[model samples]
Target: MFKSVLVANRGEIACRVFRTARRMGIRTIAVYSEADARALHVREADEAVLIGPAAARESYLDGAKVLAAAKATGAEAIHPGYGFLSENAEFAEAVTAAGLVWIGPPPAAIRAMGLKDAAKTLMIAAGVPVTPGYLGEDQSEATLTAEAARIGYPVLIKAVAGGGGKGMKRVDKPEDFAAGLASAQREGQSSFGDPRVLIERYITRPRHIEVQVFGDKHGTVVHLYERDCSLQRRHQKVIEEAPAPGMDAATRTAVTDAAIKAARAVNYEGAGTIEFIADASDGLKADRIWFMEMNTRLQVEHPVTEEVTGVDLVEWQFRVAAGEPMPLKQDEITLTGWAMEARLYAEDPANGFLPSIGKLEHFVMPDGIRVDTGVDQGGEVSQFYDPMIAKLIVHAETRQEAAEALAEAASHVQVWPVKTNAAFVMQCLEHPRFVAGDVDTGFIAAEGSDLAAEPLSEMGIEDAAHRLRHFAARSGDSADSPWHSLTGAVGFRANAPTRITQAVVVDGEAHVARMLDDDDHPMTRLIGLSVTRVIAFENGSAFDVSAFARGGSGAGNPASDGSLRAPMPGKIVATPAKAGDTVTKGQPIVVLEAMKMEHALVAPFDGVVGEVGVSVGDQVVDGAVLATVAVPDAR
Candidate 1:
């Protein structure tokens, strides 16, 4: 293997590669922009290089800068970890031209499958069934709408450039076609810098199944089974599992064959994935599967594939880049267990799953389960990158056991200050539909609110109250303590009937909590559930505090009040108003852009912007509002 390789990406993916490379005794280099100066990936890698400023266009997207970094670091090969330049055909070609090994598919393969429209055409030629839609080279809005009509109602308008659901829209009827097309084109242009689009027949009750394919310069290729990425939101995958459930032996063979066929059609090499949209209505029938696009690089959920096949795909990448042939033959590869991966994003599920940004205060990752994260506690989650905290992956003998493990793991994950979708992820893993193996692309959105519903026990409030009450009793009556008496000597004494009453808003309902704890009974009562564990933490100075978490039901943890904010880290594209500015409901306030996607922060109700803490182009995190609205008539 090569002595070293440079990962041309940031966040969890870069750190993930570094972990594998370090184990293989391969020195790894990380490239970071200004925003990622203190990012975990940079700190973890053996060597790091500064590429450019925060904007992806000037930094990670700059292929020449990456090549320069590789040369400067003496990196023998460059691994484009998933996003940034992973699927960029030109980047792969540039790396190869610079005499650096490209740890991905060949430039020809990338070019053939880079654009969805072109890839569909190639898949058709290769005899792999494709979704019947419009892949023609017509850019006009009228042309697209006409094509959608010809194709059928409920067509999906997808950006021909980027995948990750950046520029995708669904039209349920002909009347919604024009507006949806315009919006898709606008988002596509803003995100990918390409306004081109393709219309495809929307598979009702679609199941996203993709096969992992590996090849070498010797032209030898083999296929790894499939991953069911049916649990999705806004066209982006939220949860993925290996060896799709309910897939019979015949359909599995057919889908796997189709995936390999699509790969061989392009003469693919290195690690790539052929994604197919299967109509699950007929239970994964051979003829019901159609080609979706191919991912020309290592996938984010590659761990699930590894868990089942017991293969290290990154090692395979390194071997291939070093001019090695396929490591294992078709018959050698085997599925040993089931695996599931949940993308833990620093985004709020309650607030439409908007991106969240901030320092990870007391960030506690779930144990037992594998967590690949690029951020540590106190590291700033910048507004110039993806707000993905980590990928929580677990492997078990069976899918049910894996799901149970994943659910339990997510429940224990603690992200302080910044809101996360940890609880939301757990909810999905334990979702009955998911457990029963009856899920689809739209399952999450279809039943998301119910899944995110709050439990009635108010247990978390009771627990937090118990902990805070104990701290307040001995809390020195100093200026530092909010409840401290002015005398500066702890007003309340230890075990002296600590009387505390605080009201907190839970799910928009204000609830009052009264606690009384004395020497005889140090802990408070919850009517039925008893407080088993209490953790105390000391903040800056004399601000010592403790937290009580109730068991049995996860109802008492105090997290950021559910807020839809920035999803991934990015710059505030636009802030339209100042403090005290009255705005109507649905009025756009802050336009945040991350991963080249723009998300509009809208007003929840007709109210005045209370505070203008940030300005246009300001970098804000999740819940860090460019402007906050004043609740009407605060009585």
Candidate 2:
């Protein structure tokens, strides 16, 4: 085994790799950008080095800086954890050229699978069933459209060099093919610096099933069963599970065998994943599955696979890098129990899943589960990186039990100030279609509005009212109390009949709450001053209600004035409306890019644009006003 290894990544994956390396008695080194100077991973490593500025292109993506840091720290190997430079073939070769062990697959294997079109060709030549698609080198739009026609309608235009659903689009008809192709190519160039694309047949009802494969320098390859990642939003996975809920013995064998064959085809070494898109319109079957793509590094959802197979994949990566043989053969590996993982992101489901960036004032993670997090209480979630806060993983003897545990765990999460998708995840776990194993890529689009709905129960509202009274009284007695009187009455007793009416806003809607007494309540166990967060449990699920004291009833509403604000900190990509432009309700005014996604700010009502505060290419912070519109006169 190598004596020391340097993790060439950041956030949770870096911390995860360090944990395994430390347990194996290997010294770990961490590299960080300017933004991550005080990050948790930096504190956890044996030695740390600052590479460059906060921007990824200046720091994380710079291979020379990473290699210099590794060499300066005397690291024997470098582990590229999942993202950044993990799948960069040139970086892998450079590391090897520097006489350092590259703790991943050989550069040749990475190059073979780096491009989707070429990889599909290789898979087909190796007898591995691949999805029918156009992998030609012709870059003309006319050629792609004609190929799409040949493939069939409802085809997919995917970036040959894309992942994470960045440069992908589904066109259901010829009328939309041109627009879809242009959009896909633009995103591809922006994200991957490659404008080339491939057309494939889109499965009507698809289930994303991927098999975890491991190979060693001695030419031994084995599979670690499979993970069902059908629960997705915007073509990105939200929840993943191992030993797919409906997978049978015959189907498992077929997929696993095909995965191993693909690995051997590339002479693959180290950890890699072979992802397959199964046509579940008729349920999972051996022949219905086809190769989609291969991830040439450790996956974000690898924890679920580890939980089920009782294998230390990272440790295996180290061993394989040291030229060791496979730890366990295919026959020896066993799937003992079911496991599920939910990715908790700092995003607002109510606001088109826009990324929420701010300090985590009160972050309370649940116990009795595996939580891989990058931030803690008082941690800053900046706009320079992915907004994933943590991953909640649970394992149980049965799939139902695992699902129930994961949902309950998601409810126990307590995040303040910044919004999260915790509630949305809980809803998916408890949804009838999800719980009954009837999930697909279209599940979120079919039932997302209902899942994202924030409906406060009657009891929850009452609990918030009670908690508000408690906080108000607590604040009144403080030395720095802002109010002159607690209840606006002198010598008022706790049991007095005087009632205080205060307006509380929950999820942007205001509600009138009455506080009669200060009697202690069970539901008000957890309360905060000024801002009271009430967590209520219903039917074995958790719901969070944040109640903030409103300014007043007659106060001028911001919405009425037509002030367009930046929802989160981002750069203005487009500002279509100018000053004095007559705009109708729901008209796009400003487009902001943050957390790797674009969001448009729309006019709230039919009105005339009065002033534009921001211009294109300018950066703005959260809640910053971008434009203003004059309120339309009442008809």
Candidate 3:
């Protein structure tokens, strides 16, 4: 085993790698950008080095800086944890040339599977089934349009170099193909420095099933079963489980055998994933599953696989990189009980799932389950990185047991100030179809509104009112006042109305609650940010309610005032409208890119664009005015 290793990444994955390295008595080195100087991973490392600025291109993605940091720290090996330089073939070769062990698949294997079109070609030659698509080298729009027509409507335009759903779009008709291809190519160039894309026939009912394959330097490969990542939003996996819920013995055998073949074709080393898209309109069939793409590094959902197989995948990576033989043969590795993982992100499901960046004033995870997190109380969720703050994994004797336990655990999460999708995830786990395992890639989008946080119940409102009164009575008032008498009577001015109503803000709207509070009431977790303000966690949702306050003077509602403002700090990626350009309601006015996602600020009503305050590539702060629309006067 290597005596010391450096993780060329940050956040939960970095911390995750360090944990395994520590257990094996290997010293862990962490590299960080200026933004992550005080990050959890940095604090946990045996030795830390500052690489560059907050921007990823200057820091995490800079291979030279990472190599220099490793050399300076005397790290014997470098583990490119998941993202950043993980799949960069040049970076892998650079590490080896620098006389440092690259704890990942060989550079050749990475290059083989790096591009989707090329990978599919290799797979087809190796007798591995691949999805039907156009992987031609032509970069012309005319060629792409013809290919889309050949594949029929609802073809998927995917960036040949894309992952994480960044450079992929689904076109339902010929008229939309040009715009979709342009969008995909633009994102591909921006993200991967490759403007090329491929056209694939869209599976109407696709279930994303990926097999975890590990290969050693001694030309030995084995499978660790499979994971079902069908619960997705915007093509990103939200929840994942091991040994797919509906997978049968025959289908499992076929898929696992094909995964091993795919690995052997590349002479793969270390850890990789062979993702397959299944046509599950009927049920999971071996012949219906086709190769989608290959992830040439450890995945974000590797924990679920680890739980089911009782294997230490990170340790396997280390061993394989050290030229060790396979830890166990394919026959020895067995799947035990089921495991489920839910990505807990710092995003508001109720607000278009927009990323929420702030200090975690009260961050707490539930007990009795595994929680892998990078941020703690008082840590900031910066806008420079992925918004995922934690991963909640649960394992049980059966699939249903695991799902129920995970749902219960998700409901107990208490994160405030910085909002999270804990409530949304809980709802997903508890949804009838989800619980019954009738799921596909379209699950989240199909049940979006139903999965959102429902309004606080009447009992919940009454509970909030009581808690407000309890907190208000405890502060500022004298001991001799009616508040200390333990009575339900509320203190008020002599000239006040007989039925006093206390105003409280929930989800930015004000609600009136008559003050008829009992001194003692059973309530959920509630924290007072101020005497007048308290955030209540009811049914796993955070409600920031302020007593006796009307409204906050932040950005004006665009529907009423025609002012489209930035909801958070982000770069203006596109301005689709300019001054005097007429646009209809809900037309995209400005597209703000933040936290690795695009949010469109749209026209609130049919009117002419009055002003476009920001230009493309301009970075604006929270609540900054981006654009406006004006109502035309009668002639």
Candidate 4:
């Protein structure tokens, strides 16, 4: 085993790798950009180095800087933790050439699977069934249009070099093919610097199931079962589980065998994943599955596979990179209990799932489950990186138990100031369809509105009112106040008898409650309290209620002022409306890009544009006004 290793990544994956390296008695080095200087991973490393500025291109994505840091720290190996440089073939080769062990698959294997079109060709030759598509080298739009027609309607135009659903689009008809292709190509060039694309037959009810494959330098390859990643939003996985809920013995054998074959085809080394898209319109079957793509590095959802198989995948990566043989053969590997993982991101589900960036005022994960995260209380969720806060994994004797436990764990999460999808994730896990294991890529889209609804029930409103009365009563009296003994009393007077009412806002809806004399209200339990916000966990969900004394100031509702503000900190990429322009409701006025996702600020009502506060390419913080609209006068 290597004595010292450097993790060439950031966020939770870096911290994850560091944990394993520490347990194995290997010294770990961490590299960080300016944005991550105070990050948890940096504080946890044995030795740390500052690479460059916050922009990924200047730091995390720069191979030379990473190599220099590794060499300067005397690291014997470099682990490309998943995202930035993990799948970069050139970086892998450079590391190897620098006399440092590359703790990943060989550069040749990465190159083979780097491009989707070429990987499909390789998989087909290796007898791994592939989807019907056009992988031709032709780059003409005319050619792509003809191929889509040949493949019938509802074809998918995907960038050959894309991942994370960045450069892909589904066209339902010929009329939309041109626009879809153009958009896909533009995103491809912006994200991957490659404008080339491939056309494939779109599976209407597809289920994403991927097999975890590991190969050693001794030419031994084995499979670690599979993970069902069908729960997705915007083509990105939200929840994943091991030992797919509906997979049978025969289908399992066939898919795992094909995944191993694909690994052997590339002479793969270390850890890799072979992803397959199943035509689940007829349910999972051996022949209905086809190869979608192969990720040439450790996956984000590897924890699910690890929990089921009792394997240390990262430790195996270290051993394999050190030229060791496989730790366990295919026959010895077995799946035990079921496991599921939910990715908690700092995003607002109520606002089109827009990425949120701010300080974590109160970051607390539930106990009795595994949580892999890089941020702690008071940590900053910066705008320069992915907004994923953590990955919550749960294991149990059965799938249903695991699902229930995971949902319960999600509800225990307490995040303040910055919004999160914890509620959305909890709702998904508890949804009847999801609990029954009927999931697909479109599950979130089909059931999102129902899941994201934050309706304050009558009981919820009453609870908020009770908390508000408590707060107002407490704030009214000082420590030496003579009326301090009159706590929780509605009209109890030390001076004069007066009826008091307090207003509280729950999720932007206001309600009023009369102060009661019950000092011990059994129903309202205050989990967290502050001057502005009060948090209570009720009915398996967290409710944040903002309370103020009657006629006092409350949380600002931006929509009430006819001003369109940036939802989060980001750069204004485009401002379409100018001052004095007449705009209708729901018209896109400003486009902001943050956390690598674009969000549009729309006009709230039909009015004349008043003031354009920002221009294109201006960096703005959350709640910064981009434009304002004047309310039209009634005749």
Best by lDDT: 3
Query: Compared with the true structure, what per-residue lDDT tens digits does model 2 show for residues 1-635?
Result: 88999999999999999999989999999999999998888999999999999888889989999999999999999999987899999999999999999999999999999899999999999999999889999989999999999999899999999888877999999999987787688678766789899999999999999999999999999999999999998777899999897999999999999999999999999999999999999899999999999999999999999999999999999999999899998889999999999999988886678788887765667778999987887677888888898999999999999999998888767676677888889889989999999989999999976687344444434445455555557644454342222221111123222322233333333223343345543222112323233333222223343322232222223455678888778888677799878999888888787766557788888888888899878999888999887765531
Error of 1 at 34 (Å): 1.3
lDDT by residue (450-534, candidate 1, tens digit) is 6782432334335444455465565333444433221111112232122222222222222233333453333332222222222
Ranking by TM-score: 3, 4, 2, 1
Q: Candidate 4's error at 245, in angstroms?
A: 1.4
Clash count for each candidate, listed in order shown: 9, 0, 0, 0
lDDT at residue 574 of model 1 (Cα atoms): 59
Task: Please estimate how well model 3 matches the true structure, expressed as its whole-model Cα lDDT.
Answer: 0.84
Estimated TM-score for each candidate = 0.81, 0.85, 0.89, 0.86
Measured by TM-score, how close is model 2 to the native structure?
0.85
Worst 10 residues of 3 by lDDT: 487-496
Each candidate's lDDT (Cα)? 0.76, 0.82, 0.84, 0.82
In model 4, which runs have C-alpha deviations exceeding 4 angstroms?
457-533, 537-544, 548-564, 571-591, 600-621, 624-635
Query: Which pairs of residues clash in candidate 4, taking residues 3 or more apart in a chain or in different chains?
Result: none
- Selected candidate, larger TM-score, 1 vs 4: 4
